[model samples]
Target: MNAEMQVILDQLEEENLGIRKKAIEALKKWEYQLELEDACLLLEKAAEIKPLCEDEWDNPSYALVTAACIFIHEDMVPVIEKNILRYSLRAAIKVLSFLLVLNTESAISLYKKTFHQFYDHGFACTGV
Candidate 1:
């Protein structure tokens, strides 16, 4: 990673929402030049960080994750899959959906494991 990009990555940890948004934008602008590892790191960080939700429907984390996922190669699927438990049922659905569009095989491979939690959560009323 370049010095400028490193600085932007550091900005993700800033307490100020505006600074974080700016940093995310900067990284997006530099997406073409981002390394796979750097992109994965950014995606991981974006997934871990809580979004600033001034507007109820708009989530910066979703946008950041989607954009960051663009630069992440298929080889990093394991790293991302391992973090599935960190996501909510709804979030895991969205991530799985996103992955489905990106790579059907990989998404299907993970769905059985990842969606089981969601299925179980919804089926708690039933004895199944």
Candidate 2:
């Protein structure tokens, strides 16, 4: 809703993945606070953007993970964790790595939860 948020949202909507990734990084670094409604709106808008084609260097998955890393409130961690599991292990690992860099406690908790879920389902990581 603020001018800064509007600009960031605009950048996220840009056709170039680089621009969107930059915007996501900036948003993460700035760590701006938003009202729940405003944050949800921005996240919804971000979700509308399509993922990049295979040839694109800047993957939208990075932005999505960055956004989740930056914007996840304490109450939203469970939801984000659920969403993370829907992604490939590589993608989930990348996102969890970022999350760990940003907030270790939450990241560890999510990792434990995800690991349990996977183990219960007979899923296992194939490589070290």
Candidate 3:
């Protein structure tokens, strides 16, 4: 990996959650350049880090989810599904966006299956 990628990866390993969140945000800039190995590494790290983020003001799950989408890997769905309900509305919307980008038919089917769940989870509001 390049020095820039190295730094981001190092940041992701930091004990400071804020630093890790910033690292995820930084990964967004590397979307087009990320190799498969790097994307997988990032996805693994993000999956591990995402569940630890509990603060509403400092959540990194959204950035992590978007980074997975940016990588365009087939593995994104499981990662998204694992945490969809835990994410804030903003992050859940990102899940929907990823589905739309993946396939309309699949998105429609998944939406049909989960629409009630989403509504029951209090995701029916229009306001962001």
Candidate 4:
């Protein structure tokens, strides 16, 4: 990763949520400059962070997911599938859109599973 990418990655660990959100925004703005390695790292980090909001704008993790989707690869599928259920509906939809484009068959299966999971179980963590 480049120095700039490393710095942004560090910002994700900051105590201040605003800083983390800005770091994710910076990643989006610098998407063209991100290598596959950088995207992979960002995706990993982003997936681990809980979203700050239901809307994508205020959710750093969701924003990062969208940005990372630009560099989507076959290897990233597991991460995407594993994390989708944990995301807010809006963010999950955004992720599902990318999955659809990446691999329709898997995406369809995941979509069904996600829909069933959400419909049957609801979000236990969010109480929604």
**Taking the tens digit of each residue's C-alpha lDDT, what string does model 4 give over 1-128?**
78877887688777677887788788668655467666666666665666544445555566666777785776666776766765545667677777778766776688677777767876332211
Give the C-alpha miss distance for residue 42 in model 3, angstroms: 5.0
C-alpha positional error of residue 99 in candidate 2 after TM-score superposition, expressed in Å: 6.3
Q: Note the Cα lDDT for every prediction shown.
A: 0.58, 0.57, 0.59, 0.66
lDDT of 3 by residue, 1-128 (tens): 55786787677667788787777678656555466666555445544544344565444545655665674555555555555565646656776766767775555566555566887766742212
TM-score (C-alpha) between model 1 and the true structure: 0.64
Q: Summarize candidate 1's per-residue lDDT along 43-126 as a digit string, tens digits.
A: 565457554455432343454455556644675567568655554333455566766666657766876666676587662311
Q: In angstroms, how far off is 22's CA in candidate 1?
A: 2.0
RMSD each, Å: 5.7, 5.8, 5.0, 3.4
Q: Each model's TM-score?
A: 0.64, 0.49, 0.60, 0.72
lDDT of 2 by residue, 46-128 (tens): 33555454544344444544554455555545555546555544545665565555576777788777777777976543211
Give the range of the ten consecutive residues with the poorest summed lDDT in model 4.
Answer: 119-128
Sort the candidates on TM-score, descending order: 4, 1, 3, 2
Would you give me the overall lDDT of model 3?
Answer: 0.59
Clashing pairs in 3: none
| Candidate of highest lDDT | 4
Clashing pairs in 2: none
